[model samples]
Target chain A: MNSRISAFLADRLPLKNVENHIKKPLPKHINWLFSLGSMAAFLLILQAVTGAFLAFYYSPSPDHAYDAVNYISKEVLFGGFVRGLHHWGASVLVIVVFLHLLRVVAYASYKPPREMTWVTGVLMLLIVLGFGFTGYLLPWDQKAYWATVVGVKIAGTAPVIGDFVAKVLRGGEEVGAVTLTRFYALHTIWLPWLAFGLIAVHLFFVRYYGSAGTPKNTPEDMRSGKPFYPDQLFEDAVAILILFIVLASMAIFVPVPLEELADPTDASYDPRPEWYFLFLFQLLKYFEGPLEVVGTFVIPTVGFVLLLFLPFLDRKEERTSLLKRPVALTVTCLSVVLIMLLTILGAIAPRLEPVPEQPPAAEQTAPSQETPEKAEEEAVFDFGLD
Target chain B: MTDVPEEGQQRRTFFKIGMAAIGGLIGLAMAIPLVGFAISPAFRKASKKWVDLGIADLLKGSRYKKINYTFSAKDGWVETNKRRSVYVTDQGDGTFQVYSRVCSHLGCLVRWDEGKDQFFCPCHGAVFDSAGNVVAGPPPRPMDKLPVKVEDGILYVKES
Candidate 1:
């Protein structure tokens, strides 16, 4: 008992102090890729907190969903800002997670004890995407409604399992009241709980391995240098504090948009999801029918599986950056290309563009060539139909 | 005993360094809004000031008049000009009833048709009775009213 207590107290208690949290210096080479992991986690909290509050005012019914969103924006205090942050936060979070994953690949930070970290991160990325696709349908506005119609149609393209997946997401043949409730449940309860559990698993790896510092590009990584307790903790704390300030500033101002309520019958509004999903939208466009089958499902799935195997596949003799050749360069090129492609596709992806709506074709000009009696008869037909 | 840089040693040095860095950051965050709050009055003068549109006597029944006003908000950036109209009628008890000419349906400028004894929406064919009640057509709601107060024979509107 005496020895154990002594061990506990003698542990320096450095884990809890602000000084220990900030003073420990990091390796100089940490880059933008390294920064996004913290940013992704930051956005998750932002989304969760704002989303919980929004749930307080929102209703799940088809008729009321749009109105409720509008009411919160117009009638409720600070509701606009909360709503905006959740929306914009989702867009930005997806971006940061992609960068985080790319950094893991480029620096080969996913090597060794870090491979599971990368895998869990990929799962998190997909889950984030799940959150986004489901959440897009919640407002039940024209854009959200129709954009998701297209999205579900594409989901229905997945061979053997397409209909089941589509049915589960929509809760029926068409998106209706049941779909909204199902999505609301997924958004507010099921997805978040699943996300929390997955996040805990993901972060446990972080805590176990500590942060990978930078690319261990030299022989020195083979030797012990610094204990992670103080240095890494400090860096993580600084990131967290900065994130807190951003959240506070955003909460104070940039409230979310509650557009004129989501009306499914308002067929004129063209549906578009938040910008990040535009690549997938573009991919679906580029490939039609058989090719589309490969583009949407087969290709992305295979690409993701390939990415999972990368650490094992590139088994060179050295962890040294100077020794590593083609793999490093390939990783960098791939990250840049994918990001650019996704961004551009997001821009040009054909949305369910507003149908042309030709304005009832000008009342047929009363058939000027017709005799007066026939014209009179035709006019009577118009009136008679009414 | 191990040889050391001092008694409180390297740990004390790290603590002092950290405190200064963190204190500086937190101070900077606090200072930005403090400065904004301090100069906010000067910011207000550089922009627009709310203009009062006068007592009910100047307004009349069945006529739409657009009155423009400017609101002073925050610094160097002046707010854009604003416009609204007042329509007033006799309530028969020596009191006058007034309503804004703005349509609640979609913020289109509502026209008072004295001949028709109704308010007409040129955009969507919405018709309102003399009392701003929807009598015919597609307005899902009634007209919005502006709050007004009279002080010493002058009228003032509530602006946010």
Candidate 2:
């Protein structure tokens, strides 16, 4: 019966291709770190599922946005859980994608035939960040509104096209009802589609070239390893399951913070971007006045362009390991260190004043009222979830 | 006889061009309007109005008062009350001076630092003197000055 069913499907589809993939050879040297790719994929799927659930309850208009989010947390069943997964999942996805890129660099996997893969990987990183920036504004809270204002304004500092980019982003001169809907559409529809297409192209390249294996190993040695199905894939599944457990626990125990509705004219409110953006925020502090474009545009654009064309620039075929490539190793280490330092600095940097404690459920809609002094402090760590 | 082969090639080339032209036209038809619809707001100019800050008596003191006011404006499909604040000082003369709180560096709100007698932008540490001129930090220009006028004892500032 199984054979007959297989034969029936085989006649209708390319079963041979699927079989080949399932039985493909993988390097025996594969370790826990190699599973990071699959872990990221797992998180992406989780985010998509939860994000869809959110869209069901979420009304994109500014009038209902904060209230809709509040309803999701308070009224809907499993709403907080779904939203928490998406919130925490975004942060975790950035870290996982960063580490994956780092791992590839360390292994020199971006060399030669895999150049396009590296390029796509870099593009996906930007897409993930785009997802974060656009999604941050969905809550329509004070931080969401102000951060987007700062973000769009930063985009506007890019010389000639700056004003136009800012206009397009805000959908006008201000971040109002139009901006909210635009970000909602982008966060839910456009970014997801872009991510899906990029992932498809990235995976195509990955499968076509197979695993890059270890820098220490040759093709013959890599081929002598185990078949992927019950070997590497089992490990990948284990890693994904462990990550899912951690994610679900975080979702259950920790409640996502929904701050008060955004007051656009609140001058006292100290606005900070999400943690993933803190580095850029910190970097902007250094470049001011006539040189502001250097921080806002030139450095970032140059860095991204350099990363995209790294494979072509560094064509040392045999210099795979870190020991063989001193310049590459140093640059990678320095870049990572600088980013971490900047993020830490950005966090500890003094604000004009501390953001007032989050108001309770009752006072959420009344924007003009002062937040009560005896507010819950647990919501303080809620800063980094986006 | 040799022209027969060349004639077939010509017909094939013609068909290829014809099909591509049809496809291009169809693609452009949808793409043009779709793109226009998506970015229509960027090209739109937000309407500006003069908002009254209820009587010039509030600006009697030497210190700048951070006055907040809400004006009903049509933002996209919704008519909502947009709140904005400006620092208004008596200028110690017959005329009153008003400065917009938006930092010239980025768009972060600037707070009036009474202790320092200047305006401080918390985002990048930009400072502007009471007169709205850049005093320190990365602000390329002075704090934005608004067009203010008094009519019937009411002070009004132009808001966009």
Clashing pairs in model 2? Answer: none
DockQ of model 1 vs. true complex: 0.02
Best by TM-score: 2
Backbone clashes in each candidate structure, one number apiece?
14, 0
The candidate that wins on DockQ is 1
Q: How big is the RMSD of model 1?
A: 15.7
Candidate 1 has what TM-score?
0.61
What tens digits encode model 2's per-residue C-alpha lDDT throughout B1-160? 6998798567546555654554465346334433443344567678888999778876676467888889999654446999988888888776788888888898899999898899999999898988988998999999888888898888889983
Over the stretch A235-325, how does candidate 2's per-residue lDDT look in tens digits? 6766766677677778779888777799987877889999999999999999988999999999888999998899998898773777678
What are the candidates' interface root-mean-square deviations? 10.4, 17.6
Q: Candidate 1: which docking quality band?
A: incorrect
Candidate 1 ranges with C-alpha deviation above 4 Å: A1-35, A217-230, A240-255, A263-267, A320-324, A349-386, B1-160
Q: Which parts of model 2 are misplaced by more than 4 Å?
A: A1-4, A354-386, B1-160
Q: What is the lDDT of residue A187 in candidate 2?
A: 92
Residue-level lDDT tens digits of model 1 in A218-307: 444422433333443345446656655665566567665444555557776666656776667666666775687987788677777877
TM-score of chain A of each: 0.78, 0.90
